[model samples]
Target: MTPAARKCLDQLRTLLRPASVATAGGFRPPSDPVTSWFCRAVGQPGENLPQWNGRPMIPILQIRIDELPYVPEQLAHLALIVVFLDMEDLPFDKPHGEGWLIREYTSTNGLVPLPEATHDFKPFPIRWTRVEDDAPYWEGACALLNMRALDDDEEAEKAFYDDFQRYDQTKVGGYPTVVQSDVGVEDFVFQIGSEEKVHLAWVDAGIAYFFRAPDGTWRWACEFY
Candidate 1:
């Protein structure tokens, strides 16, 4: 990896570790989908389906950190947590897809590991970077945001959603929601709450991304692609 790329990765690691206080934007549902599914499956008022491809669809959580944690060991743990929560509501088989977890920095050739592991597909050019220890690592890490995308088989999808519905139904209450957006990737703002949160989320595709708030509560956010 270039000295520049490595630096960026280190910076991201710091931001993700102990975590940082920053306005995060992604996608999530106003109502917890799993909770809603359980309620409806058991005959109760639950949240409607998430919108996808223009229809009510499942929302996936995607997190991007401007800063990473100070400790390096904790980075993997934090990333895993984000991955688990993001796919917890989706219908899928594995936690992150079929293959072994591939960790790499985003690059113009695709996703290139620090050591430059051989793989298929060229990397994509990275738009962000950071300086660390006078070396370079990829600016940020990229892993499958949702596990549902792992198995293409319909059975896997069904199993994933079924498990998700069961898990949601068992929870006592719902999680709080947060919303975020950007106009042409310039103007950015976010809000966290109940109805107000939902309305902001609905303005987009209704797909809200979630992350652990500073208070430990899950907050939702979304960006218009």
Candidate 2:
């Protein structure tokens, strides 16, 4: 990795660490995604991403530096979460298909220890349930979001799809969704009023990336892309 990229990666990891969570204080509305907090903490220049609704939107990273306790050692062994957006329809000459990829780098060596996948895929760090289309994945995510309230399940699901249709017209692939059935389900759930709600983060090819909040809640950050 180049020195500049390495520096940014280090900054990102440190910014996401639990210790840094305490220093992350802001006054964004709850409707905002978790990426807002990350943008606030890291202060990275926003990229010109896709637009949602009539307004443009940018990429956002959601991170909770407070809710999850940190172990100094764990920081040394961290996973790099990389999500690929809108790769399904690259130009005819461009390589296409697949949207998300993850690689774990050791702070000790700053290198990817594992061999790369045959054609250059980094499959470790996250067990992703890849969905070829966005609708189903978004539906599942919306359901997980309001898991406690089933009464409005249908409406919630429709709203998610409608929003995506209006804003994200591209074919989205490699979108990852994790539910309670996954190994770390319990840890991913937000405890509220005797109800354990599952957390979810979904990103399209353009703007809108969701992240886990400090209180174990889920939030999304969106801007004109």
Candidate 3:
């Protein structure tokens, strides 16, 4: 067997499945005949995406809180949490809100669906699925984040970065799949990968990490290779 495949298997076998749940999201096919993913969606809009100046923000991620495989207590009361980015330029060098925003809704009742996107803004619908056994798959994650390292670091060092990886998909509730240094505190909420199917790209294949601040506000950072 290929060495990489064997290494992956070994990593998987050792990962502990904690009670945390993970969910994956991806784009829906264009011909599927529906614009709204009622439970949740990615690019497509529900209530209108807010705007700055005269330009509207681009909807990138949306979650129907109660619909999740295991609802987080913090979000259980909300109908959806939506993430929107600047339509043209994403702010990597500046503070989080300079280019993006997150909004939470308690109800969707009597809301009007947004008008069809123009040639300038194309909407991509999304679908969600519950995935099993997700967790921070490597001890390196803890060390990198300044958290306490694994018990057997001296022995585990031999396998560093070569054999194991955390579940690195566009997901909620697992250890973040980072490309460079990890960002934010341990109050990790979720990470959004570059959803190529939805025309979402962060610089070049970067993913944005979301965190919950002590005061209950949300914060974000991006990492790329």
The candidate scoring highest on lDDT is: 3
Query: What is the full ranking by lDDT, best candidate first?
Result: 3, 2, 1
Off by over 4 Å in 3: 1-48, 93-97, 116-124, 137-140, 143-155, 158-165
Over 4 Å off in model 2, which ranges?
1-76, 79-84, 87-97, 108-225
* Candidates' C-alpha lDDT: 0.24, 0.25, 0.55
- Candidate 2, lDDT over the whole model: 0.25
Better of 1 and 3 by TM-score: 3
Q: Comparing candidate 2 with candidate 3, which one achieves the higher lDDT?
A: 3
RMSD of 2: 20.0
Per-residue CA lDDT of model 2 for 62-145, tens digit only, reads: 222222333222222332222222322221222212222111223212321221112212111111121222322333334334
Question: In angstroms, what RMSD does candidate 3 have relative to the true structure?
Answer: 6.7
- Listed in order, each prediction's TM-score against the native is 0.19, 0.21, 0.66
Order by TM-score, highest first: 3, 2, 1
Winner of 1 and 2 under lDDT: 2
Mind giving the per-residue lDDT tens digits that candidate 1 earns over 1-225? 344434433343343211122222233423321111101111113323332233322221112222232212312233212111112233223222221111212212221112222222222211112223221111112221223232454554343333221110001112112123321111111211112221223233333333333433433333333
List candidate 1 stretches off by more than 4 Å: 1-17, 25-59, 69-93, 98-225
